[model samples]
Target: MDTGASEVAHDFRPFFRVYKDGRVEKYKLIDHVRPVPAGLDPATGIETKDVVVSPETGVSARIFARTAGGGGGGPDRKLPLLVHYHGGGFCAGSPFDSTSNGFLSAMVTQANVVAISIDYRLAPENPLPIAYEDSFAALKWIAGHSDGSGPEPWLNQYADLGRVFIVGESAGANIGQYVAVRAGVAGIRVKGMLVVHPFFGGKETDEMYKFMCPTSSGLDDDPKLNPAVDPDLPKMACEKVLVCVAEKDWLRNRGVKYYEALCGSGWEGKAELVEAKEEAHCFHLFTKSERAEQLIKKMVDFITMD
Candidate 1:
């Protein structure tokens, strides 16, 4: 009897399925950094200028303003803004790290708008809510007026509140989605959201057992690293979501679930699930990957598309 089940297991890269003692075991690898090329520097490639968004929180961030083709725009020309958050499993990385499309620099150039990359407080030392609170505050600050403590030159020159976008990666994407959900509650309607490999939901399900094999689950086994949160957020609140998922990445399922949840929740937001056919999470960090270029181009098209 086939029983709608397969006796043959699938093994790709570090992922493998082992059936023994009337039980099936699944193995997945995490904690290893994907190899990105050396020449591509998403972090230091863009010309970064400093700015401050809040004095109360003492938050400092960089404002990357994309130069309109031919470098001719003065401060008066208003442009859309993408508030970017970098990936590091919520513990490592920065906005300057993935400077291409999802990062501040990339969003600036790709979206052809101002990119405000928020440097929120990290976890363990800061822990839950701190990162979330800081990110939300930054968005609010941008929508509102700037305080005196922030960088005057950058704020005065770049940044326009009318056209605002929110973007993030890994744990940062976690924060981005949370912000979008709350933004709706607070009457803050952002132009769009770019979520790359975001981690969502905290409760463990029966299927997770297979994915979390004793020795192969890796960092995902650690709650702090892949922490779970309240799952009651209203989906589709974000104006538009550019959901980028990697085929070989362990986080692929979670990203897909989040995307489906958004649509299921009845959000009018537009969505495009871009599968990096041969890539994995944070593959964009590797500049030389052919797939990386495809990912960046797609992201730019998503954000800038009229």
Candidate 2:
């Protein structure tokens, strides 16, 4: 059998449209929105639901949840929950189309837990904390409220709050890390955070030049520094953080610096850095690479362990 990577190519897919030359071009993820109606099992496939998680700027922001299994209980009663944030360089991408959500759902199936992929607001049009605020709000809602109106009816029936975990890829990982730091300071009891191929503060380095100078993708360049978030938040938060980076990724050095910064802050958390050999940024989302698959299993085990 071929490993996922053996069968997959370099994945640089996007989830939003880039408007230039008066023409709108659809991205890889945008085409995947509102997937085929999914049911309760793998045979029925995954279901995508677009629901408004909250409102920002007086307008509602929506998230699409790809849910499978973990309904009414058998042996997996009170199952664990994984909430995911998709990667689009903080500019574009949807939980519905991200390949990570599918792989994460497989993890949910194996762990007998529920996984949620949040569709937060994107950048340029929305910008900065708009995405962060939306994702953080969604997480807060998961911890404090469950409307039972989400994709998983069984989640409310059997979710194990004690085992709740959070995950994000690429830019999403940064958002996840920030969320964990904030939650820690606020005294919120979340199980753990899984940050894959995260992009830390580019504003602190020359890396912003690579992303902005030519502006190959204006979306990637714009959010390199969002003035909305307090710069001091990193020092105040991010003590015990879990950070993973692809060796070949442009953001690898930044991820390491972020880890070092957190460790230096004397915060009371562990920093786990896993290397993805020969991989690029957002490598884990492809789920087709042998290394990526192995890393996913490793991360699941780490976050799930007490």
Candidate 3:
């Protein structure tokens, strides 16, 4: 990910620039930032607000929930909490845009759950474990509100900390799994995990991951990237897990393999695998079709189910 070269050098432009002396320049998310709809969607009764997750690192998140007295958040006073992670290939992507905001808003109206879309630090500039660390820090910050005495009145008023779901898409899926694994060691309570097209590396080292995390020990050995080799996979602490993979996605095999490994690892939990026929990676986030609806509906049923 740096430029103090000794062997192979990486320069994945349009995403990042690696200069001499190990300085890396990253491109901003301008395209995704634009065309965003302003403020809450009153029609859906969904309201979103941004909060500082870690002020020191500029890490923040967009919190989504149905406003009080709104008809969208279901009949329950306290709803299941969904701590979500957006996918951007670990370099760029966010929950602040129109697409992500709209999606979260829809989830709010449909599933009636309070969602926290984390905006963790990206890589090349910050690197792999840094993103992971910052994500876990956000989770810890959220955990502090479990007592209902912590900051954030919305969480205190709406979120059911006992029934929490860690959900992610693509790279965010990878991060979600990491958080779930670390939560087990940290003793944090997480009900389940829903990962969509998880961004896991293959047998051959992934160039993207290598460029983002130059120090990583390839895909095969890094438990952070390869959960198949992660010993803690069986001790994930969560009660259940749902892994969704698209048939046409190159990572589909890996996601399927993960489900197989999880089931055979004696994880002692319910594991669900979903495949979107003839679909490509992260298609549900784009094409607003019946297939996408079905996928999101599956996710909603999983989150709202007992």
Error at 158, model 3, angstroms:
0.9
- Which run of 10 residues does model 3 get worst, by summed lDDT? 2-11
CA lDDT, every model vs. true structure: 0.61, 0.58, 0.82
Error of 2 at 164 (Å): 2.2
RMSD of each: 10.6, 9.2, 3.6
As for TM-score, the candidate ahead, 1 or 3, is 3
Quick one: RMSD of model 3?
A: 3.6
Task: Report how far off residue 41 is in candidate 3 (Å).
Answer: 1.7
Cα error, residue 40 of model 2, in Å, equals 3.6
Candidate 2 least-lDDT 10 residues: 57-66
Off by over 4 Å in 2: 1-38, 44-51, 55-76, 146-155, 203-240
Backbone clashes in candidate 1 total: 6
lDDT of 3: 0.82
Residue 125 accuracy (lDDT) in model 3: 74
Among the numbered candidates, top TM-score falls to: 3
